[model samples]
Target: MHELIVSPFLGNHLVVRPGSPKGLKVPKHRYLELQQAAEADGAIPGWLHKPVLRQWGLDLRGQNARPALLVRDTVSHEYGRASYEVNMACNWECPHCYLGLKEDTGMEWSDRELLLYLLRDAGVLWLQLTGGEPTIDRQFPAVYSLAYELGMMIEVLTNGSRLHNPLLLSLLTERRPYRLTLSLYGATEESYDRLTQRRGAWKAFRRGVDAALEAGLPVELSVIVTRDNEHEIDAMYDLARSLDVRTREYNNMTPTYFGSGETLSAQALTRGGQRGVFTGCDAGHTSLHVDPLGMASICKVARDKQLPLLTEGLDGLSKLGGIADQALLRQGGCSGCQLSEQCSTCMPLAQRYRQANAPLGSYCQHTPKEVTTA
Candidate 1:
């Protein structure tokens, strides 16, 4: 396993340790020097040796201490983050899942490889692997390996159904992800199984969580709340505390990506917490999202700007910024709304709410009191 990676982040270069968030910024000259040292099998540069030990607790003093340093040679664009949905297939079906239809489909191995390289050329240093459940995808391991080898920090957003698989666990153990974000439906078996609409989902989820923690993998839990398991909300928090792992709560519900209101019925009245007022985001400017078939979009919620990455290659990203600008404009239902200044929901998300024919108070600032309730 490689000890550290050197890649371009936005405009600057950074030396980042796998499975860790902490990173050290390096100048262009030092970045080149480190690349040369790694390639020529030369001595560890004096400047890098101490920081490696101090930041990650890895020593470079011993004669056999040859830390595998992976360096990215070029970055043609400035995109620093991206999310790829490996496949739409999942083992369990939750009522509130934003992905309306879970289809077992994805790009072939050859196309998958091409997409990873395109991401590298586009300067994506932080890559997220998401899906209906990324672990259940057949090509997940290979995709993960290729991303890691390309020096991109990886975060796997999974449902935790297949984490207990020995072969999958072994691969993750050898090449750790920056973080494994597991979604927790409920604290108890009845609630868990009922909510996911699967028979043995609770048992499988528990086994996966236990195995992941036991292996000392970096794990974080996303406590998801819905009408089905809202009764166990307090118990869910207690369970996370007992497990002694990092956790966050997700209570906000949105219409499915396909513009369906079917998922809105599962929304819980209890507010999990504040997500802060949404000012704006660098969706297409610094980050982009890719679906299962290599189609690029501005962001998950805003699908108006679709780019054919497989056909256009990295050149497609150049148009994303402009697409982002047009999609974010206050138009349609939001045209000339006085409350647009203090609105928490962005235009793209508001558009989804409108398409679903949701309640007037659900996403519109026109109903201020209801907007704050969730």
Candidate 2:
């Protein structure tokens, strides 16, 4: 059973147990002093009761009590150590996308509201906003504004196509938080265009990067490892060095695809004729994904909903505990395989390959196993 308590500092409602270590404590004299102060300031209404200080005591006397205090205590211990994904939309259509494809409609407002409330309530100080291109949504700016107001430092992952627009640059310039991550598919236009699948996307992305740099936005670059561009990794780093950005900060490419499962296949992905599951992920525990539909998922790579739809509010996110636990278990050929750390084995992608005849193809094939892990 959860009991609500009002925090003295934030003045927000927090659900905790009466005897839990996380519960608020007010001495009798202090309580009386606060009550008197409230009365003097005319802040006390007739509905307000007299101050009553209660001592902390565990109520373990009841039958059928299933360690409520223990559960609450565990939750409190992990209070601020959670991560969230705002959405799964991207402007580019890279060969490897874990979240699947974009729907005809945009994200619902209810889902956004639920995520906002949850982040605020859970005291999540950092949030990453992703998408088919989070910036493509007109609501992107508003969401950034709200995250800022609530004190969360926002990080954005984008293909850098929209940042070329002056208005968009100005908006991002005004409300900067951490930095924007730009995914670089290739160093040159010909190479980049081949990966993006859209003609002129390379030019647009380059211009977007220039706009971001001109606006003085802190930016990072991410490259996806693919057979087409695997040899260019060193050159990409050289380009980063010339740009005067942090070259060491570059993220190695992963072959995780974002759209429909129909795009990738296991036969195409298997290396050395050995099919194995991707392992060593604490995914459901430390990370979470909130899809456009407002459903909570473990990893963007997996389509399964670990928690119920967060329509009620942020508090509903607590329901994800069971899903997180279940994800720890492995099945099929993935069981007990040692390649977990080196392979970008996404369950959704594997399922997609199995459903269709698509093969598992990723930039990982071009990268050395050690370097890929590195």
Give the top-scoring candidate (lDDT).
1
Q: Candidate 2 versus the native: TM-score?
A: 0.63
Across 174-203, the per-residue lDDT of candidate 1 in tens digits comes to 888889999999999999999999999999
Task: Tell me the spans in candidate 2 whose CA falls farther than 4 Å from its real position.
Answer: 1-90, 247-282, 336-374
Clashing residue pairs in candidate 1 are none
Model 1 stretches with alpha carbons more than 4 Å out:
62-67, 272-275, 365-374
Against the hidden true structure, what lDDT does model 2 obtain? 0.54
The candidate that wins on TM-score is 1
* Predicted candidate 2 versus true structure: per-residue lDDT over 1-374, tens digit per residue: 21222222222222233212244444444444434443344332222122211423433223221222111111231233234444455566666555555543445665666566665565454467777677887777777777655545567878889998877787677666466888877788887888777889988988898888887888888755555666677787787777767532323223234334433331122122333435655555545666666666666656455455465455555655556566545444445545545556455544444444333343222233333221
All models, RMSD in angstroms? 2.8, 12.7
> Residue 15 of candidate 1: its Cα lDDT?
91
TM-score against truth, every candidate: 0.95, 0.63
lDDT of each: 0.86, 0.54
